[model samples]
Target: MLIDTYGRVATDLRVSLTDRCNLRCTYCMPEEGLSWLAKPDLLTDEEIVRLVRVAVTALGVTEVRFTGGEPLLRPGLVGIVQECAALEPRPQLSLTTNGIGLGRTAAALKEAGLDRVNVSLDTLRPEVFKTLTRRDRHQDVLAGLAAAHEAGLTPVKVNSVLMPGHNADEAPDLLAWAVAHDYELRFIEQMPLDAQHGWKREGMITAGDILASLRTRFTLTEEAGERGSAPAERWLVDGGPHRVGVIGSVTRPFCAACDRTRLTADGQIRTCLFASEETDLRAALRSGAPDEELARIWRQAMWGKKAGSGLDDPSFLQPQRPMSAIGG
Candidate 1:
């Protein structure tokens, strides 16, 4: 295991396949997105598989997740999943997508060894969806969710970002919809990862506000279980087995238990989502660095990992790269 100085073992690795996205979401970035990484600069499919192999074989990584500006936008996604699944003591594989392109590829992805998926859908209303995503593809997302579920991606999780004065009143509707469709729902407090650097903590929704709304519609009891390094705090809804998760990064920091790291599409390794800087793995990869050396570099990066991103610290500042570029 790659244990940080803080004693947190990194068992999960998030690899960004690409930074290109099909949608221009209001919450994700400004109407006009930033310049993307050149295709020649991004990691090839073979290079990505080799990196995953090292993490699973040389390190104690047990789970591998694919993230992107939108993961499905990557052409070799299925092949990536297949390569990861072929490893000895294979790591569990999952993906987080915006779901615009998922309907066409979910079954193929599942057939290739994907274990689960988390789709980002903020609102169910078509008008709200268009306003939020700057795209008229809410129905496409809905289709993709159904396709993922039908492909046996059990408990397909829906990741929604709660923004004040926007889609906040849809909590009850979102919950009821999740209950009816059997998809686990998680409402995340908006974080300061936007490409525009426009996130204001005061305007962002908090965990307390989310629970209060849930209480009005259904009962919520905090789950009495270990949180480990997982970001979401699980809770049982209305005394049923159905679970609802809340991620309060701004109000309730979980950096102390964050046993995860990220690799950018361009091959930079980031120990934290809000890290001020990243380690350039692409330089090593292009310089004929072996798996052992690559592993060593990863370890060295984590060795300096901080306890967490101190959002409340007076010196706190957003990363130069937006969330899309950072592979969150």
Candidate 2:
């Protein structure tokens, strides 16, 4: 069950298909970009599928989310989704993408057995989007979101990171846009995950700020229920089924309920986003380790999961790898 010493079982797995992305969001990477992994270092389609099979069939993972610097950039993505869907007790499949190329691929991915998608879109204004992403693809993202919806990716989620002095003022407008389009909106507090290592607690927006900004335009009622292992704190928008979510990874860490284990594009297992070390599965896979051995290694890796992200600790150091390399 991949149960940790803390008694938290990891039933959700995040797999990074590639560390490559099309848009260079300022919060994620420098405009010039960081050095990307070489092609050989990334797990092949077969390797990725095998690991996912083991996670579901052996380790009991019920949810598998494919993430990337931009998952849409992975050429074999549709095929990968198809293979993962064929697993016995088939896990719910989803993808996290920047949404640039999604406009063209959403339908194909949905047909390939992808259950849904979460697209990153920070601002409604094209100029703000351009400044934040260092790319002129705002329209592309909107089109992509529409395509995902058209593809019947129900409850399409939009992930927004509020950067102070940038698109912070657009919270209400973003929510309004999301609601109008039937896209579930989630505002995530920026963490120290950028490749540039420039994030500061004071500079990033908080969950409080997002709610306050939202209240100015709409009434939000705290949705009645335990949040479970989901990171987002959901609020019923305008008092109904429509809602907005805030993932305060910095201010309101939900590590206590975390049920996710991450697999890097290179096959390293990361138990926490801020983890200083990674467990090497690539080496084991390449060296002809059997399935049981692979599952044992994974179980051992997750058993050492940290109690919390330690962002509050005075000595906390940002992880060496950026969000792009680690997968969101």
Candidate 3:
């Protein structure tokens, strides 16, 4: 097990299939975008499966989520999912995407063993979407969501990041939409993960702000239960049956129960989202290191994980790699 001194064992793995994204959301990167990782630098399909195999077979990861600048953009995604699904103790597979190409790929992905999807959609208005994303693909996202539902991706999740001036007021409407469509909605407080490093605590929306906005339209009762390692704080919308989630990653940090380990597209292990250090597994994998050696390096890296993401500390510095590179 990848157990830290804090006694937290990692059972969830986030794998970044690529660092390249189709949409340049204002909060994620510049309009021109950041430098893309070279093809050779990225892990091949076999390499990715091998690392995942090690994590599941050796390190005890049970849930595998594929994220990226936009995972749907990966040409070999379906094949990769198929391979990962074939592991001995097959891990639950999911994808986090911007939902650009999902309309065309959702069914294929579901067939390839992808259990479900969490799409990033901030607003229902096309104009606001364009303004925030600097792209005119709002309808594409909605279509993708519908397609995902049609493909039987049960409990399709929508991840919304509330930026203060941009669509922060849409909380209630977003929730209403989710309830109507039966999509589980989660509102995440914007973190200091932007490429430009322009995030300010005062300017970013908080979980409190989201609840305040939501309470105006709906009665939310805190769901009874320990959140375990889940990042979202769930609330029963209105009376029962449906719920909304708030991930206050900054203000209500859940690092104490964090069970996630991240693997970059290039095969670097990131013990934390805000980690300043990354352990390289690619070099060793390419240099003929045995699977046991690879697992040992991974265990050592997780053992050294910081107690928490120091977002609340005065000395906290934004990670050098932005959210795009870090795999959200």
Candidate 4:
């Protein structure tokens, strides 16, 4: 079941369709985006499906999520989703997106077998959104979220990064807006994945800081449930119905139970989001490798996964690629 050296079973696979994004988020990538992979270098839709099939049938993968600098940027995304759905014992499928382009493509994506989506929306204010992402597409994100909900993409999730001076004050307001909109909200403590190499701990907001502010308005009861491989720690808000999540990657680590792996658009396998290196599978894929061989490469990679993501290590180094390039 693709168990790692530390007995962590790998069931969730995040595949990057492309490293090209529309917006340049401050916490994700540099204002001037990095050089993107050429068309030939990016894995084809057929290659992606073949790998998913191997992960599902051979390596015991049960959930597959398509990510990207922006997955919707890929023209073949729906087709890829369709092929993955056609797999026997089809895995749970989902996507992570910036939500700018989702307004026009939400229904098409749902029809193509995408189960749900997690949209990145940092702020409700248009000016703040522009300042954070270097793009004035806040309206587009709002419209896309509405379209996703309208398309029956149940429990549409909104992911916000907690940067202190930037959008920290909006924490309570964001939660209230999410509750009113009936969308799940997640506050992700900013990790060391930015392209600027300026992720100082002092400038970031912790999960405790957010919850403490939230406590002033509503009662948050931690949900004593199985977190499994999911990154976010869930909570029941005020009462039963509405809930909120906080991904305390920095302050409260959940590395021991990490059950996820990532594949870059160019086909490199990353066991952790903050990994220093990645195993290149694109070379083998282009060399006419078979399914079993690909499976072996994946297994070899997972077998070497460290006990944790190593964020706490004094020698911990940031990944060469930015968070956007590495996928969600």
State the TM-score for model 2: 0.99
Q: Candidates' TM-scores?
A: 0.98, 0.99, 0.99, 0.98
Clash list (residue pairs), candidate 2: none
Name model 2 segments beyond 4 Å from true.
none
- In model 2, state the lDDT of residue 183: 93
Report clashes for each candidate as comma-separated counts: 0, 0, 0, 0
As for candidate 1, its clashing pairs are none
Q: Which lDDT value does model 1 have at 131?
A: 86
In the range 1-328, model 2's lDDT, one tens digit per residue, is 9999999999999999998999999899998848999999999999999999999999999999999989988999999999999999899999999888878898998989999999999998889899999999999999999999999987799999988888889999999989899999999999899999998876578899889999999999999988999999999999978999999988899999999999999999999989998999999999999999999999999999989999988788999999999998
lDDT (0 to 1) per candidate:
0.89, 0.93, 0.94, 0.89
Predicted candidate 1 versus true structure: per-residue lDDT over 1-328, tens digit per residue? 6888989999999999988788888777788748999998999999999888888999888999999899998988999999899999899999999888878898999999999999999998999888888889999999999999999877799999877777988887898899899999999988888888888877677888888888898988888879887799988988879999999898888998887988999999999998997999889988999999999998999888998897878679989898888897
Residue 263, candidate 1: C-alpha displacement in angstroms = 0.4
lDDT of 3 at 228: 97
Where does the lowest 10-residue lDDT sum fall in candidate 3? 160-169
Give lDDT for model 1: 0.89
Please list the Cα RMSD from the true structure of every candidate, rounded to 1 decimal place: 0.9, 0.7, 0.8, 1.1
Overall local distance difference test of candidate 3: 0.94
Q: What is candidate 4's lDDT per residue for 44-95, written digit by digit as tens?
A: 8888888889999999999999998899999999999998988889999999
